[model samples]
Target: MIGKKKTDATMILSSEDTRLGPSFVEREEVYTPCYCEENVWKLFERLARDEDEWYAVVISNPSRTAVVLEQRAGSAENGGLVIWDYHVIAFRAIGGKADLVLDLDTRLSFPTPASTYFSRTFLPLDLLRQQFGEVFLKVVEAKQYVREFSSDRSHMRLPDGRWQSPPPDYPCILAPDGVGRFEEQMSITSEDVARRREARGWGTVLTLEEFRDRFL
Candidate 1:
């Protein structure tokens, strides 16, 4: 329950290099346990409504934190770590194959293989703990996050309102009436996240090894 307002740090980290061409084998019930941003907006609206492209990441850390790591929801000699506060993930790339990370609350392999899903799910920013030692990443554009994402789950609530977990039956993902807001498209920083992409031009914010070396 450490959610302050997720991060978007201006999110837009695709320099483009020929993406999109494979993947589409969904049918496990589409998943929805803790709602990783509505299961990555239903895997970015069924693969960008048929091949628009991918990249809707949003791990976090400006103290909002995130721990991940071989997770299925903790335990097992710490093999299944999971300390999240922000962790929406989506990734798909084509042109030569190898980028796939679509994490539906990862137990791994719903699409893993962004170099084995970030070397088995990120956990080596100097061994962690130092305000998460810089993890932030917000790359968007999976159909522009299905037309500028929004969510009124109210950070999952819980301060008398109830529901700190057990949400996501469906409904709640608005924003388009006035413009983005669900905590500025799930923030990472930039003070109060003005929905940058250089002011709505698109997006831009990176790290996590500068976005996995653009395709490791």
Candidate 2:
């Protein structure tokens, strides 16, 4: 079941850039399968053991939001055991085979008007490429992650001049090292996010869909 919510159209600005990032909600639409959680965890655990390759697990929220568990092999840049990002929608897990009610799509649905509201300005994948550059794409490709997130997704300006997941969320996980050794660069405090936006100098707000079409 998808969900629909009102679009306030209020966006968070970046301190490093004038562009408005993705919008935030007081509460996110997220759910996990009670029965499959353990099995899913096991699958992830097994994938994590390999130090020469990368693996991931994904989970999607009703509103096109996806969570990714990115595990990568160690590298000269990092020690082994690194888990970069955990909530990447583009690689989230949706139920395909399970015992009870085998469908994850039903449990996940948009919230009506909210879906319509976003549809008017949905973000495209191309924009993400432009904003983040090859570094981001390389990781996705390296992990062989699937596009579980929406085919169209938006990005937020991070404190570092780079674009990243919006505040109150961990979008990308950078694990130069193998699983168990990871570093998070995109997360920020609400105060920090606000401060960064002011630092960058912003003029207006744009929806994910709007931004993708305009700049990306």
Candidate 3:
């Protein structure tokens, strides 16, 4: 029952569904580990540009390992191929029972349960440690990750100051207005999380298995 949702559940899950609380817009992309960092940062830049109050975030396994999700075999209903390496998602507390997790690339509906999102993406913590050593998985919430994607300085520059690549196309996955609404939700501060982390004694390094057990 943890991952399984009833058929009727799907009907109620939409980008505009109030039951899921609020929703966020996400850009569509062919994800790959090689470019996931840039992609996620780009997404943050997009969100920040559209909504100044939104935070830029990156959540990943301690190892920063990348996993492939092929559309041919693992497409979300939206037909997106996600190669999640340090996957990016948005979060804001909406006065609901819990925080809303907006992961538009998933097979499940947008704004699904955080537990469901983690279950689908992150590998087991124990396995990660075995392969990558005592790395601590972390959540990085930065006040300024990037400028607006449409800004003149938006694209990453090369050592010579040349543009790295063309700016990303407007997000094609969901409406921008819907995604920006989350910026108004209660803030989830780093200090708040740190206090909980200290009380829980998870240490700085958290393995994938441990994270799954604790969060999922």
Candidate 4:
């Protein structure tokens, strides 16, 4: 859920460095597969408190049917597909320019253009409704809608059998110093998510290409 933070007059108009945007300098400190909603919301809350232009966003496909493109360090072999579940990020409107998506968990530079973010990730309207509910979708502002679907990280668990409620300092699946492919390490895939949905008697599973054509 998003919480409004009051910002001072001076902080409201302050412009961030466009070169790097508002990304964290120490990238190693950022972790993944933790309490994504809570951590992302906390980061956005801090930014909103400091700058009035910044706002927190919680995006997800509760049906967990959407697929996103994930680029790693290598060439074609390094790239793979990932399913989009309940994820959170921050946003800021750039006058006359594409909006910014601040997703700390992603490898992309923080405050990347919204167009770029959407190109990599696909969130279908049908999936969004399943997660956020119908009434929330009627609203134009995402901030207003997210509050109704706020995630409780207290019950979140990691593959290593750890509770995400009390987030650890470094809750990443792959250590910063480790050398391994993220997809291999995480075993994240659209097929797996689809299987789970099918087992639950959900609708037909859509392929990645189909999802891209229909949603993107």
| Candidate that would win on TM-score | 4
TM-score of each: 0.30, 0.19, 0.42, 0.46
Error of 4 at 213 (Å): 17
Cα lDDT of model 1 by residue, 1-216, tens digit: 232111111213343522333445352445566667667777667665455447777777566667877766667697777777778888776753436676766666555657778888888877774545566677777777778777777777878999877776667767668443666666677542334234243355666666666546
In model 4, which regions exceed 4 Å deviation? Answer: 1-32, 71-80, 95-98, 123-152, 157-166, 169-216
- Local distance difference test scores for all models: 0.64, 0.24, 0.38, 0.39
In model 2, where do residues sit more than 4 Å from their true spots?
A: 1-87, 91-182, 185-211, 214-216
Tens-place lDDT digits, model 2, residues 1-216:
011132222223334221112321111222232212222223333334333322222222112232111112223243222222322221111132111111111212221122322232222446433542111111122133222211111233446665352222323322233232111112223333234313221121223333224323
Give the TM-score comparing model 3 with the true structure, all chains together.
0.42
Q: Candidate 2 clash total?
A: 40
**TM-score winner, 2 or 3:** 3
Where's the lowest-lDDT run of ten residues in candidate 1? 3-12
Worst window of 10 by summed lDDT in candidate 4: 2-11
RMSD of each: 16.7, 20.0, 10.9, 13.2
> Which residue ranges in model 3 land beyond 4 Å of their true spot?
1-56, 61-63, 68-85, 94-98, 131-137, 140-216
lDDT of 4 by residue, 1-216 (tens): 111011111112225534323533332333234345445544543343343344443333334333444422113453434444434555555452336666555555554666676566544547635754211100012333223233323235567877634454543333344433322211224454446323222122334334334323
Model 4, TM vs. native: 0.46
Residue 51 displacement in candidate 1 (angstroms) = 15
Error of 3 at 4 (Å): 26
